[model samples]
Target: MVVHALHIRPSRPGAWLLGLLALLLMLPAKTPAVEGVEGELRGAHRWSGEVLLSGPVLLSEGASLEIAAGTRVRALAPESSLRVQGVLRVLGTAQAPVVFATPQGWHGLLFERPELPQILRHARFSGAAAAIHAQAAQLVLEAVVFEGCDLALKALREARLEIQGGRFEGNRVGVDLELKSFAEIRDVHFVDNAEAALLATGGCRLNISDCLFQGNGKALSLLQKISGTIHANRFVGNDGALVATRLGAGLDVSGNFFEGNRVALASNTFSQPLVVDNRFVKNETAIASDQFSTGEFRHNLFQGNQSALINTRRADPLVTRNVFERNQVAIFCDFASYPQVRENNFFGNQMAVKLGTYQSAAGARPPGAQREAQAGANGPGPAPTFAEERPLQDFVDVSANWWGADTDLLASLDEQGNSPIFFDRRDEAEVKSQDAFAAGGPIDWVRFRPWLIAPVADAGPR
Candidate 1:
């Protein structure tokens, strides 16, 4: 009965324990004999029942280690770990849950404490590569259960965590706040993560609330200096929900809901991103503004989306007071898209602003727009890789909103005095760009009058 140690029980009494329980019932129900441990474990220590970890085990710096509840702690191969720099406590509960497996894989849980104070409630980390790897640590994970991990918490440098009510499943990355790390993830439940179920970059400082992101491929991916406060999360069926590409300041994605996501809330190459009171439903695109990202999309609620805001290339957005309902095309405006759409509530939309053609401006030119264009002294082609010295607002600002229909047929407009809710470029010819318009010119007008004789009644979702 000796696998790694067999936990020393030399007593040979009662007929050698009934002939070693009939030779442990004919050997192999997947043999398991714990109690091994290795290297430095200074002052205090206490583990329960089975414990194997046969290689790396340094719990030094004024040492202390306590793990009880239902301790399993296996790992006798794959470079075993558990190197906490000082104290470590894994007081599991909730029906005795404390398992730290190693099914042919190991090396995890290396918390090099700086501010000390560690914790680990109701633990159950599996096959690690990083099931809990902090550096300047200060953990406090409760109700934990990261399964099949590759990285279920890899906080580096200024590490500080407080993850509550956890359950990250099939992790590839369920919490990887780097550099200036600081987390606050609450009521978590991220499931089926392959890439990002919370992957903040460098200057991290998150505070995600009431989380639930399901079937994830993205569910929150903030780059560079990601700042915080993503409240009331729920994102379902994700392929992408909540992207914040080039961040650097205090972020905020208020009261979220995002259903059936394909892209609910993206904001590439950042410049500003506030995105208020969210709710996007049945998404295929709710709020994407790529390349040159935009700010403040106030009081949201786009329902049944097919578009609900797509803005491409040099994307411009200040869309306020939202609530576009029954959308099929609420706002798509592609290349160099402009969007200052104001005070909203365009109900039952089938097409409340669509325009995209203009030949897609050579694939919407983003990603540094193929630089190396040296030809000008204001002459010939090339030269401008990045311009926009401020001015460019050539229309596409759907003024005061409230176009649900029939108010004398939207005050009778059409013929480019637009109010047929626009699809623009004078409704076809592939939406303008014959060198930017000619033949009876003057058309990119979606600047819907100072309209809104009713229904802005405090826009959507508060």
Candidate 2:
């Protein structure tokens, strides 16, 4: 009967197909951009093969967050690493110097912030493995320029580094403080490193100031346990500038300037150094200590070293008030280490003290049992002897001393009766007549003893 409900409009064909699908979803959906290279950047839900800028770019620990600087990051491979987590900020300067290179060579700057606070300034971190591998964060190297990085700043574990004015070159180890780190190097410039220009280990706590350890092999290598405070530094032409080993403890080497080093201050065994007011020149061995160590040489200023000061074998160490000049062998005690020589200020040294023989007279000391009562029997003896009344208590006042080169202060004496001695010399017009193989040489013992009062310039605890 009513075969004509032909006018059945259920809201006009579903409201005209829901208003044509809301005007085609408000019209605007066609994003597919990709261009980089002028201070590059990418990542807006990246996916054009998940956005990568050529070569090794596998950074997926929370996917995508690559920042750039004036941009020049080129590492086609060969230890490519820029792997960060979440954030990266490469802001550079000093004439725009942010360049982490490598297609065949160029390695530097690798931070893995485990604690945060990583900064790199005026960057130019060169040829890698290290120019910066500071894990456990808190690094702030300014004016960075570490070149040929084989190891030019690798502070691991609790790192808290803060190097300023850097320039470490040809590295093998120009700053490698491992575990428990706490470096604070200032005004850096360690050049030509083959081994150490600064290699502290384990219990590290360095604070080297005004640095310039040149031509390094060992400019400052304190292994095992280190503790430091080397000040106003400048150890040049190094072979072994300052090598404290084993249980190395608190070192406070002050006012440094050990020049032409071949061995400027080598302390082996369980060291406990405190060498003060340093300025040992022309080093061949300007203070070498072995045997079980413990040092405290004060007001240092030994000049022209050619094997000047080497205490061997053990005990009694604390040579005070130093200022030995023109050294050829200013102090060399062999086999039986006993060094408590006080009030030092010997001039023009050829051999100011070369005491030897602790065992040789067919091993003397048995004619009735007293070679000074068996050299006052105490630990460390038996074929390596010396220690005949050492423990020398303070004998200050080296009589108006200004002992600088005046030539021949006892030349050569090594078989035993240590000679070449010069007891006192307060101020012979601040001694500097200049002729230790002249030609304008030898006479700048702190500019002709400016006004002598240098027991480390206002002695410690200030």
Candidate 3:
């Protein structure tokens, strides 16, 4: 009986193996995917491929997980989180950033251990409730990209966060720091956030510098005893650039540039910030302080703004050595606001000092007007005791200032004809409030006399 035998010809030794490898190469490559990852990572792990998470994951204590560059982590379930209780080193390169994405909203990364000091660099997170949420944890995030998140990063309960060279765009709030936390955010770009780009409250300390904040609702808000320095930042096209609430002892904002914002710097509710050497250009109101706040605005440059400085609601601040050029109104005061304007240079301003509503020329006079009693006093009197009533303020002091190279034109003031330089009670008499409880009378009066012949040498930003 003859059996059919199949004969195959081989070209050379290992030729079949080469053919098999070629066939394998022709097939599609599937990246190794870890599906439905949850529960505890028991031991040290290094993930270099795609990982899909269905629920929450807990990195066990003492276990370390290192995600390599180009790793893609997708969350299938909503609100899923990676809780890092141990060391998690997600080291990604700029060319191959580790990605964490969710179509729905997820929790992103949560760090709870303070001693572990987890770090994530060159990572991208999107569609998260919070991209990084830490409580008393020490975290360092560098070159990260956060987008479409409700809140990009949050530090609570004494958490320490150091973020550098990241981009936070299209988020509700870029950073929320509270509960005595500490953060140093540097060289970051915060753009198109819905709410405040950076907010620090509850006695937190922040050191933010060299950042760019643009097209946001509010660039930065510091509330309730926030201390530290915000230096050399650029704020452009925001509704409000910086707002400080309450008082911080050593809050310094210096060397910043604000352009085209609605309000550049606002001090409210007794906030006393040391704002120095900043440049405000083309803003609606460069500096607006109100609600009994007292701040030191020194050596700032205000140019082409609608109102260079607006003081209202009993805000009493020291305005000195500032340069106001080509502004609509250099200083606008109303509602019992009292800003001591001295040593400033005002050039080409439409109205050097404007008094709106409740205003009068009670203190400011014509070229030959007479002075009043106690006019030499540069500041308001000390607050009366709790039992005694405070005395009424009769005049507002805006003396010792330089009003352009045409300083002598101020001497050619005509009461009936109007000077066209200042708008005060001379233009309209003080409007007394009809409401008995309202203590509004001539709070809008401004006195600009003892004027300087030429511009001050120490004016404008240092």
Candidate 4:
């Protein structure tokens, strides 16, 4: 109390405290809140149970929707989906791959929009009807494993699929192409499927390069009017390597190594396909065609096959410039169908060419006997002793120089040691004469005929 009516100011400490309280009142209150969208198990907010999403859950730019490794997602009944109408980029490493499996069978990722973007790598999807169904969208998947699914990648109706370095195993069908879709499958492995490893239907175009197809029921099957280019691929240990039917056109199969398959190329009637530049080793039949189907067999190497290089019922193929080596019987033309044989190397086979009663007796008759018989019947009136038909036109210009066990024939002639003996007929002996087919050297025996069989037979280029 001031007796003289004097009012005193507050202390400096009191003023400072009042000012600090006023500053605290002006500041906004802070609370603990969720940071990102729900259902993601990372960051502050983690969701459990089925995540029923009505709208697309977009992640932050440059951020990935990462499902933790060894984590399983169980979708709710009648609502089993994680539909991404936008982009769903999953980045999984080899050791820790993200899994999108359900408690029961369901759909994993349904990409609906045409412009939806998705990138899935090193991920696993199982127990789903379709692991990944991309419709009219662009999908880039690599190092992914798909199992227990009907179809691994169902790219439908103008969708594009570029799959590389992935494994599609234990699925009904590995990759199903439909309705003008385009797919480029490279560096992939497909095995142990009930149906075909890669099935292309609905006029699609599949370019399979540098891939391995092994232990599958049917490796690659093409139906409808689809066109496929299978190049630089290895098909081994499959039931059937390739089966194309129903008027499919523009199938360019080249530079692919086919080994140990049951049937290499099986084409039905009305399907004219091109099979060129492929190596067929130890296959049951390299090519088998039937009834009005035309096959172009060119620049392909056929070795160690059990049956004919080309076994056809009625199709007259355009066979040109192919090498047939060590096969059992090359070119078995059955049912009166004759392939147009031209410029092809027929050597090292058990039987180079077998006409199978298709060629006429006159055409099959031996060359030397025909001339002798005409002269004998016209003037001498005595028939020749040997009358056997030899293959002539079928082997237009076949060189036995590289024939099996005949490589020595060519070397002897080059050395100029001795004039090799060529037998005109099978019932001949080795005689030292210049007129024979030599083991190695070039000699025209048609002009000279000394001891007919001995000189021609023993004089082979050697």
Highest lDDT scorer? 3
Can you tell me which runs of candidate 3 are displaced by over 4 Å? Answer: 1-31, 359-388, 414-418, 432-434, 439-444
**72: Cα error in model 2, Å:** 15
**TM-scores of all candidate predictions against the true structure:** 0.38, 0.34, 0.87, 0.63
Model 1: lDDT of residue 147? 80
Model 2 C-alpha lDDT versus the unseen true structure:
0.61
The reply for model 2, stretches above 4 Å from the true place, is 1-94, 98-110, 113-133, 136-154, 157-165, 168-176, 180-199, 203-211, 214-221, 225-241, 247-263, 270-285, 290-303, 312-325, 338-348, 356-462
For every model shown, the clashing-pair count is 0, 9, 2, 34
For candidate 4, the 10 contiguous residues with the lowest summed lDDT are 446-455
| Local accuracy of candidate 3 as per-residue lDDT tens digits, 143-255 | 99999899989899999989999899999999999999999999999999999898989999989999999999999988999899999999999999998889646799999
If ranked by lDDT, best first, what sequence of candidates would result? Answer: 3, 1, 4, 2
By TM-score, the best candidate is: 3
Tens-place lDDT per residue, model 1, 207-317, is 989889998899888887688789988999888888888884478889889998899888887647788988999899887877677788898999988988887766777
TM-score of model 3 (CA atoms): 0.87
Whose TM-score is higher: candidate 1's or candidate 2's?
Answer: 1
Q: Which 10 consecutive residues of model 3 have the lowest summed lDDT?
A: 365-374
